[model samples]
Target: MLISTSKSLFSSLIISTRNTSNLFIGKNVRLRNYHNKFPLAGIKVTVLKEPFNSQLIPKLFENFGAEITIFCDTSNIKKQSIDLNLTNSDFVKAEVFGTKVTPKKYIEAGEREIDLSVDGDLNVLKKYAIKSDIFINLENKRFGEIGFNPEEIIKLNPKLIFANISNFNQTNSKFVFVKENMNEEYLELLHQNSKTLFTLGEISCFTKILLTLFNKQNSGKGQILNLSISDSLLHLNRLTSPLLLSIPNAFDRFYLTKDKKVFSLCLPTINDQQKFLKNLNLTNSKEMSAKIAEFDLSELNMFLKGSLCVCIC
Candidate 1:
């Protein structure tokens, strides 16, 4: 009788696993179909040299269904355009930025080919600028220096949104000298990492541009937006309290298990911390670490299931 009951339970588990697998497969098929109708459909965006030559910003616009026209100098036009194509590699590498992104297979089939053009001649930019709803310039040069005037473009298209990406706020007098003389070494020292400051700044700038676009849709207005890498780094630094330095391990956000696998722990509020301590019957992170060390990663995951403590392993 005992053997029969165990066999019955094992069979049920196998059936449940198969059902879950099929459900996920069906969901993925639905997601692939959903990309046919994107939120930014019919939006015309003109991108002039991506920030730090990362190619990520334009890809974001493409992913959301915008018609993208990317203009680069004669030297980089071909290379940048080729990089936009979806490759069959296991990971997508942003070679210039020194980062590898996780493969998102869903976007591969739906991506439209980008329109590339040489940006040296003012006539070409003027032709597209007049028709573009959104204009992004990350070249770090004034419009006049680039061969055209922003006022002329605005006059032609009053509802055009312009996003300027730079290393420092151009209008601020204090950062004017630094912006002109800034080099790779100075940037690395400022953020204590190479290229991370630019990456963060670009993402923040992209988010702000999207918010501005949302506002423009309702208000029927266009505006100029500016983002600086230095300002983005400063904003992030301000979030860390100076008093945190006095506490031991106050900044530790990850813990190790018996199997040597690391996982993140997030207790954002006092209530969350209290709930985590009560659920684990522990008073501090040290105790939590000791407790976690007793189990392998798989066992720890099972142990913490349905608990208030937010953990990612």
Candidate 2:
């Protein structure tokens, strides 16, 4: 199933299979090198969503050698293409030639846009589910609002790894939306908040999905993964800085260097602070800004290396 490395820091090996009945649990099998480079080769993935939403998921799967097929309606595809400035000729080429002749922009937007109407028959989705190893749903709609039944699809393909990304969890009816008729000021606020929420949500879902894939390798079973943007943001906030939860902007801040370059530094503990100050031959943190201003970004980077300071440029 799954083979992980020991704590010695050696390279780890992972082996996966659909049939575990013939697998030897603890016995060592002779290792052989194979020319195949892609870890997810032969894995079939089906994604149900517009091309604009959750583009990274399909790209990630494609990078790992998984065959990804995205199903969405024609209007959404046209809107996305228009928004991204993709020409009809290029879109047609991408559709006809697939990845072989796909432009970088088309790939970035999402590859091979299949037109499957959301109002279409459930049997169409079922056809894909029966052969797919992984199914990802990035539609903004609630589970009930989604045209097909997830349970029925899973029953058709027991080994399918189903993942759903929503604005909120299934139980919560509250949806994220701003009507076109809304005032500009109110719409702007909604847009900004939604952007931030979705960004954090995508990060959380990406991590959880990777972990779920690993779990499936170990257990040889499939499970449903439900991720909400708001919930993910809360979870991330808790894990990142629990003590500074009440204090706004308590985390690291960026500074402009003498050469106008930007960087962020963190000296969390007393020892780190002492080490940083000692390296700079300074007595207090009060001189940090002035001292940092004296050096160029490159010089500052070199100075922070062994001073127990975490610096990002």
Candidate 3:
């Protein structure tokens, strides 16, 4: 997710820019939270393309809101199109990896997928993006020039990458990208917030742009490698304006102890949480949970819910 401060518009824009919105798969915590926050309230939401999340929209009024409205993606208004922002566009050849490598093959060597499409080509994608007060980019596919013109795509990435961040970076906003894979607690927070927001795929060069956009001066400017909260912030001078602190999380951790679904789709319990913890040597390092302290992996939810907001540096 991107958190950008627009000095011109004068607003703190925090947004999620990924397709995880589909993860709701008939359930939306945002809607759930909205109901809890303001019962029978009418809030405006704009979704692009897929009508998956509409599951929650149909029955919203039964519980709250004087009127349920759709301002974008009106195709599913009957189901739950609160806001509509449809646009005209043409289909572009899907760039699976910004390279010649397909996702499945890339992962065989332990990699991630990223693809891209151009504005006129990705017209549908671009159209949906600009419509939002805060555009969200669901890394549907990262397109890049794998062979001859990679920069063609790389250049496209920083610009086409939609989010409140782009709005700010387009204007040059100060921000931070924290890195510390050893961290699981705050890491989850970053993941939870940004999983649907910012995407770097697997390539670090593209990632550099992703990072620099927070605030950069070309030539690897505003980019920090091997992210660590303390070290990254240390390099950043005090900012006169609000800063967008972004942490990358989605899947670097494999431990699953607290997750209600320890085994998705009947998959065997892959890693023993306790053994995983013990292996981490966190007991000797800074930690919070005794479960984690004891060196045992646990449910993702358990590890998360028992998560300590304060880190045990």
TM-score of each: 0.47, 0.50, 0.23
As for model 2, its CA RMSD to the true structure in angstroms is 13.0
Which candidate comes out best when scored by lDDT?
A: 2
Tens digits of per-residue lDDT, candidate 2, 86-109, equal 454444444433432322353324
TM-score computed on alpha carbons, candidate 2: 0.50
lDDT of 1 by residue, 56-126 (tens): 67787777677888765332222432334444232222322234332223122323222233353556777
The local distance difference test score of model 2 is: 0.53
lDDT of each: 0.52, 0.53, 0.24
Q: State the displacement of the C-alpha of residue 188, model 1, in Å, after optimal TM-score superposition.
A: 12
| Model 3: residues with Cα > 4 Å off, grouped in runs | 1-136, 144-254, 258-313
Query: How do all the candidates rank in terms of lDDT, highest first?
Result: 2, 1, 3
Steric collisions counted per model: 0, 0, 41
Q: All candidates: CA RMSD in angstroms?
A: 18.4, 13.0, 18.6
lDDT of 3 by residue, 6-102 (tens): 1211111112323346554444123222233233233222222221112222233223332322222212112223222321110001121121111
Give the TM-score comparing model 3 with the true structure, all chains together: 0.23
The lowest-lDDT stretch of 10 consecutive residues in candidate 2 is 1-10
Q: What is the lDDT of residue 115 in candidate 3?
A: 23
